[model samples]
Target: MSSVEIKVKRLNSKDAQFKQTLLSSLSLPMADDEAIDLAVLKILAEVKAKGDEAVLSFTKQFDRLGVSTVAELEISSKELEQAYQGLSAEQKNALDIAAQRVRSYHERQKIEAGCHSWEYQESDGTRLGQKVTALDRVGIYVPGGKAAYPSSVLMNAIPAKVAGVSEVIMVVPTPDGARNSLVLAAAYLSGVDRVFTIGGAQAVGALAYGTKTIPSVDKIVGPGNAYVAAAKRRVFGTVGIDMIAGPSEILVLCDGASNPDWVAMDLFSQAEHDELAQSILLCPDAQFIEKVQASINRLLPEMPRKKVIEASLANRALLIQVQDMEEACEIANAIAAEHLEICAAEPRKWAELIRHAGAIFIGNYTSEALGDYCAGPNHVLPTARTARFSSPLGVYDFIKRSSMIEVSEAGAQTLGAVASTLAHGEGLQAHARAAEMRLKK
Candidate 1:
């Protein structure tokens, strides 16, 4: 489609209603999908009640694979090894490099980032600290059927392994009983303990509430379609989960210096993920924006996934005009974009101003795609403005901390009176008495 015909909803920050318009356009109505929720709730409820039977039943119904026993669905270590061994030399080398990089990053995160125990003793002889512990088992959900992302397996499973999680269970849908060897190879490289050929809400439910065959996991992490997102939300209280990811997004802030083709391709990179994925550009120079648009139109027909890119650009993508790079950074923080690219003359100068973003891709050479595959940082990131509150998955996500408090006699004597006073003020005589009992007579 032509740039004019694309209708990507271009806006200028100079407009009075710009803020309202931008946020309104940026909104994703994921919560409004009641049909998805209803289906997810039923699947979750069935799995909770019927266990493995429900999982197998849904597997056959959704994936068109009829399996009588859940045992038949389980993929063994021998198979994972075969999948790895069966890869071509080039494929194995790519997996090896990505796995090592991801592993090294998480290992550093564990050692340098306070993943161990620490204690401090106060003057009053009261010891207070934190005891860090990793989860016993975790599940990594890798999306299957449509596409296979071996990168996702490394990103999700390696961190759990680094954090000392005992087992990393994996569930990937094998539609029509057709499994992706690359995904299985990735699972092998990442040290995932088990693999189950299942998908959708049923897989999530099985992970959250252990079935007769599949043991329950402490946490679940990875990305999936709409139904999978809903299942994770529903089973959150039962099992910890990575953030609820929205459609992929990348915001490129340019200073009118970078090549228009590069900027256009960067936008297309995210747009090609799906029609809902968003790609935006914030530039002070209107001419640069026009160049990027022209590049987009010229390059559109060349993309294999051009149809998906067109819908994404037409629906969610934005080509915005900002006052300057400073204003661009300000708006970037406001949007809290999942992937923020400061493709400016001095990228760091603008990136330093960004307060909220899942991950910042700095300079013209640093593209969001690099972060997805081999970058040290986890690709499973916060989305839909969640960067303002949450964070990317890491070694930290696989570990939990318990508060340690040991009050000495002297500390308890002093603390008791304060506690007693507050407890009595709150009309809890039992609480006051309990504190009073701890005081030295």
Candidate 2:
């Protein structure tokens, strides 16, 4: 424990005002969204109307790349290979391992999730089923403003490749023409077909609307700044987006048995993402909560991103004392955190009660950081309670399902009248006639 208090909010579930307080605290401030959206709208419109010329102009303005044409922005295939070959032995091995693991997991997910075309024949000679096909191409926007994320390239591109997408296009801003070698190496490893040195709403617009150099993609994945999020939201209909992700979040539901230091670091894992990120702890053990707080104070000062972690903790972090393990699970469901860690004596037992988290980490050793990197599961999870309805980014996002129907003469004779009646009842003569025409004369 340090002499300085961390000033993270403390709450007790037994209090009458606890739920209200917790819900209020969960709402991250959204003061700048309107401003960001307005700016993104202009960028999207410009890209839609002007295409490559607009992309080049915006790239010049934002990234400070004075390239005369959009073609100059595309990172060559040879450059990608060079990026991979130039890595140190350890870095190359790590990238290979992570890439292999991600590929294996997604390949398994493809098979296990039944991402295939299937049909069933009925006794009436009618066949009905679903046909699954991969998206032709996709664009992944890896945020390049704050930091370089080689992992994002692996996570986003690997799944699309596993799903058999024909092409994977990546766009990352190279501010002042500074490119991250690791990101390029990961892109090469993950089979990204195209890399463009561009970012923000302009990059999103270029991908969605299709500039002369950047072909239009069927969907866009990966994370970005506020402008990117707003741009994705605006162009959602034109191209599919993974999700409008919010800040990183981790909720650790721990029992007294787990080490307080381990638990504290787990919270820090998410808090270090940025000041807006949220780290929460739900524990029935009040004494353990105090121990964790002490550990946080002791270890926080040593973190490289100490200031970020401190602000995140002070802004949105929570150390809630629950009545028991059961209550903690209940609250965990309510929160639907992006990452949930059940660090308890019987982790699976507690995990069974969790239904809404984007991802669940069991046991004290299962840190969220592993999921963010080498862990097979895609770290691009739902956030801000979006996990309640949405799912983590996966191969399924890159595949489309089409309903297959082969109606036999006899089957159509029996079904056409039902359809005609319903269509007529809904006041549509054309629809009714279309169905009636299919009936046996």
| TM-score (all chains, Cα) for each model | 0.96, 0.97
Candidate 2 lDDT by residue in tens digits, 30-62:
899899889999999999999999999999998
Clashing pairs for predicted structure model 2, backbone only: none
State in Å the error of residue 37, model 2.
1.1
lDDT of each: 0.93, 0.93
- State candidate 2's TM-score: 0.97
Worst 10 residues of 2 by lDDT: 1-10
Best by TM-score: 2
Residue ranges of candidate 1 with Cα displaced over 4 Å: 1-5, 29-32
Backbone N/Cα/C clashes per model: 0, 0
